[model samples]
Target: MNALFLTFLFPLIGFLLLSFSRGRLGENLSALIGVGSVGLSAATSAWIIYQFNVAPPEAGVFTQQLWVWMSVEGFAPSFTLHLDGLSLTMLGVVTGVGFLIHLFASWYMRGEEGYSRFFAYTNLFIFSMLLLVLGDNLLLLYFGWEGVGLCSYLLIGFYYSNPNNGNAALKAFIVTRVGDVFMAFGLFILYMQLGTLNIQELLTLAPQKFAAGDPWLTLATLALLGGAVGKSAQLPLQTWLADAMAGPTPVSALIHAATMVTAGVYLIARTNGLFLLTPDVLELVGIVGGVTLVLAGFAALVQTDIKRILAYSTMSQIGYMFLALGVGAWEAAIFHLMTHAFFKALLFLASGAVINACHHEQNIFKMGGLWKKLPLAYASFIVGGAALAALPLITAGFYSKDEILWEAFASGNSELLYAGLAGAFLTSIYTFRLIFIAFHGEQKTEAHGGHGVAYWLPLSTLIVLSTFVGALISPPLAGVLPQSVGHAGGEAQHSLEIASGAIAIAGILLAAMLFLGKRRLVTAIAASAPGRFLGAWWYAAWGFDWLYALLFVKPYLLICRLLGRDPLDHAIGLIPATVRSSHEAMTSTETGYLRWYAASLALGAVVVLGIIVLA
Candidate 1:
């Protein structure tokens, strides 16, 4: 079998075996299978990358046609895998980061009731995401898309006994379903016009088939953007993520960091040609991304729940990716995607340790002076937080995020550039606020558990990668993408870099004063009326949930009640009662009495004679 096929199979086999294990598998065996499968896939991806570099093929594309999936008149979708530079980049992250998370989940969930089940779901997610990145056609992509959604629903509500977890899973599924509708329509339009679901064919023909400002192409791109926005949790579709903290921590690391959230970015980058044809839609993508980053940052600032803080941070960072894509910086977006995967996963795994350490207490105010108790976790958070804040010159986030700001400036989009810079400052403040408050205060809560090889090992590995991996991989990534990716011009780029770094530094200093300083500015702000109002607003995620409730939820419930107890049901019910009443009235005539019987006989005879005569 081809290496591409093998990469997906390893995870598939692992998921099947563990899912059907029925509690027969030991913890060690389960961990070995789950971790080993993804590890091998990562190894395969590395080998593929090496081979591609040593002997590059035409257009740097590799196609493996396995079989026919479906066929119609002049149209067929195949079970094919397409490996190119872009996919290769995603493959490394998905498999590499995914393996570490699976390893962590094994130890983290040990002695739990559904240990095998958790690993099963994790492996399934890895398989689904691999298919998503490697699919050769839109049909396969959509299959993988919905597959991951199903797995996320299962895994997010992994603690199914809790009603809140179930609600969160349902909310995530229903919200993203709205966007899937638009994406399905988009596929229809593209297939109707182009008569092909093959991705390479679509890319090759889109330019020759449509003009720069064509409405049809714009409509299609906008529809696809709908799916991207919902999947990436941009703007209106974002409320579900904060609630998703109800799941296990490893699930959070898997979905938010390396796999599902990045699908939207990959979709946009993969279909860059179609987006390029519709410049109007391209600009809109940037606007949505820019607005989301700032909005999420405000929400993150006041968030006290540690997991929810990371949830909002995920939204904010994804906004950066979208902003990069909007400014025609596809390479920069991918770079940020890779680096964000490593650091964000590290932060989540480290936070998991902290949560477990405090006996599962998630409130940051309740946790303090953990630097000594959990030294590994402390070190991991410091590195991860620095990367998250885009700390100057030394961290991975600075390189990738600053590259985006430079492109935005070079594109003459000062508005976008400033929006990005504002996001940078907020990122710094919220990230360090968590660090200082959680690590610098008196020990207010008793702590236990969360010290083991599985937890700390993943944390340490991610820390190493987040620190230096960005610089090492840039040359390979640049080689993978087309030549035009990083060619934005001039001295202004350098100025923006320095300015972004300075902004990050200033925000960090401000955080030191607000959360860790003597005046207790965060508390003071919480005390005031305006600050209280804004805190409520931001805590409610600017009340997006309430708005949707009024707009969609209430109306939906009303309609359901109307259908359930409609007047038509009463009308239909009345018919049976009417028949019973008529029957009773007719039965009264049959009451036993001699005179009545004689009269009835005489009347019956007369009526029969009259009927005979008429006939």
Candidate 2:
């Protein structure tokens, strides 16, 4: 526990050293600093976890206060780190999975432009996320929250030469900012009502200060949920994620798996006390999750880009975590968050490998039958895909996702439970859809396999974790969060699990039948009028981007065009305009001619004499 500060220190050092070097360092040295720093943080995290488990803190929480950040009339928040099962779980994910992603990134980004720059941004991302989960107070957490947003903008637009990439980055930043604004308002409400931003303190005082279903509390929780939705990429704010694949694949993995997208789930779970009081907001969380999962699933089914498929899958998976949070399954939510980091990271990294192997081709339809050529990537896809599809009993995803479904069912929310089941079915279809299309069929293009320890090591490790082995590592969330509500016993839980598992397998079989052969049947369906229309709609992510453009973007741009002259600026410019005009008129008499100059001087002198005499 004493060494907890080291977790942040190492990553900060890595970011500073890499950033200041400004690409002067050799790629090898840069990779060493970048990967080594995160590795050290992960090591420190493991040791802290050991210490924590060996000697559990009194009251199951520990706070390490560094200094008072600021004080204004007793409104003070400290630069403090809070540790408990929840933060610890997230800490492990951030440092552990984060380190693996950095290591794999070294291989993936080796010869790319701005290699050092890539690592620097990723290092900063990890540092910011660490700050977010570790922060004891809302202000500190919000600082981290905003920090990651900035980092995502930098990394997502890492390839700034492309206008599309820049637009994608801007889109991500702006969409998330909307949610951040809501979160800020929520923070203000909490502080105004209960007078503190410290998370533990706020949770302690919330129930006592406001009764359940209080309007203010409900508003505050809803505001916080808004922030979560934006960050987590749920529903209306989800359009940016697919475009975010315009960046490098490792950037995709880091954002999708380890850091930015999961922040929302963490927020809701961390502030469960407040959410519990606002049941309406809590149910909304589940509803958003339910809708997002099903919609994202459908969208993933139509994506041609391998990375975009994974991006939508991430949204759907986070939707599951949100659903868990909504149903009072606190541990299940965090548990799924952990397992999700493992497999989602694997899938993204493997997709990077496949893209590299196939000569930078991203469209899955462009290449095929690479199982022999790119065996590592094929195996990675298989294992990660299985985990994603929640192949019963043997994969990490099965354990986590099955728990979410059970919780949903146990809560008596049949709609949500069915949504989870539907998402499971869709997951299998899309997961295998990518696999069967990209790894099976006739070879469409030449491919090469990735070689070297850096490339294979991360993939291999994640492969192991994506299995049931990962599920064995249960989150240390006992007593840190409220015990889950309405636990369903033996027979009921088993039945739901089996049903979900069967649905997943059924989806995979359907995908195989549709895609594993000539793909003629799918082609015909896609060519048909209704199928084409539906396919295009899903491929465009149900036209959310278009809808948003019509509703918000077009109107805003129209207003900008209408006010193109900037009325306020023109109004302010009036004084300067008048002064310039008067000066020009006066200057007309003093032309660049000696006679004119002399005349003007004489006239001025006469006027001065007349004024003096008159006075």
Candidate 3:
């Protein structure tokens, strides 16, 4: 089998092993199978990368068609695999980082009642994500898209005992479906316009075949953007991610931090060819991304739940990536995606360790001085926090984030640059706020700390990777793309770098001043008006459950009630009751059943005879 086939097949093997074994396999063995499957996929992916570098694909893209999966009057979709610079980068992130998270989950989920089920879902999620990146056609990509959605629903609702967990899962699915509808329409538009779903064909034909600024292209791009927005949890659709914290911590680490959420960035980057044809749509991407970054950063600032804070941070970080893709810095955006995955996964996993140590208390206010008790987690948290803050010169986040900001400025999109910088400042405050409140203060909770190797090993590995992966992208990933699509020189200027660094430092200092210095004063301020607003995420996240109730549940109930008493129903019921009465009245006419029946038959025969005679 080819390398790409092996890369996807191993995960499926794991899913099947765990799924078929169900109640037969021991928990530890099942966990091993799950982690091992992804481990194998990661190794295969590494081999694919080696092959790619050694003997790069011609035409700057490679495709392998397995067979025609479907054919009709005018449409055909094949089972295909595509390898390009973009897909290779995403493959490394999904499989490589995904494997690490699986290892971490093995520990985090140990001894849980549904450990086997957890691994099954994780393996399935990885397989689906791989398919998403590797598909050569839009139809195949959509298959992966829906596959991930299915796996997400299953994993999110893994704790089916809790009504809240089910609700959260439903909310995520239903909300994203709204965007999926638009995405489906966009796909249909492309098929109708171009008569093919193959991404390679579409990209090749897009420049000359589709006119610049065509309304159809604009509509299709916008529709696709809607899907991205929903999946990435951008803007109004973001509330579900915070509520998603109802799942297990490991689930949060995998689905929320590392893999599933990045699908939006991947979508935009993969379709950059089409997006390039419509500059206006691309600008809109920048605007939406910038707004989401700032808004989510503010939301992160006030969240008391450790996971909720990180959830908002995930939204903010993804916004930055989208902004990079928007302004034509595809490489920089993807670079940031790789970096974000490492640090964000580290943060969430380390937080899991902390919560586990603290007897499952997730409120940051209730946690303090955990650094001494869980030193490994503390170290990982600090490293992850530095990345989140994008502190100068040391963290991987600094390199990727600064590159994006520099590109934004050079592109002369000042509004986006300013918004992005403002979001950066807020990011610093919120990240450190969680760090200080949870790890810096006097011990506020009883700490039962005996974290095993299971906990520390994964965090340590991620910490090391997060510290060094940023520099590799410029070299390893650079050659994968065509030179034309690679980092263009005019984008990353020295002056822009210095300015971005200055702004980032200022933001970090501001965070330190507000949270670390005069801590009690900050608490008192939070109790007051402006701080309360900031803490409440500016009320954008308020009454979320109630909002759903008012908008969906209540209206649906009202409609059902109205339909129950409709005029048609009343008329039908009256007719049925009258028909029953008429039947009762007619029953008396049949008292002498045989004679009456014979008389009726004779009368009918005589009438027929008379009509025939007249004719």
Task: Find the candidate with the highest lDDT and give its number.
Answer: 2
Instruction: Give residue 35's error in model 1 in angstroms.
Output: 1.9
Q: By descending TM-score, how would the candidates be arranged?
A: 1, 2, 3
Model 1, runs deviating above 4 Å:
475-490, 517-519, 573-615
Measured against the true structure, the TM-scores of the candidates, in listed sequence, are 0.95, 0.95, 0.91
- Supply candidate 3's per-residue lDDT for 493: 61
Q: Tell me the tens digit of each residue's lDDT in model 2 across 444-548.
A: 999988888989999999999999999999888988899996564689888888899899899999999999988899999999999999999999999899999
Cα lDDT of model 1 by residue, 142-189, tens digit = 888888888888988999999999999999998888877888988999
Q: What lDDT tens digits, residue by residue, belong to model 3 across residues 499-547?
A: 6667767866766677664577777898998777766655456555577
lDDT of 1 at 317: 92
What is candidate 2's local distance difference test score? 0.92
Residue 494, candidate 2: C-alpha displacement in angstroms: 1.2
- As a whole number from 0 to 100, the lDDT of residue 553 in candidate 2 is 98
In TM-score terms, candidate 3 sits at 0.91
Q: What Cα-based lDDT does every candidate model obtain?
A: 0.87, 0.92, 0.83
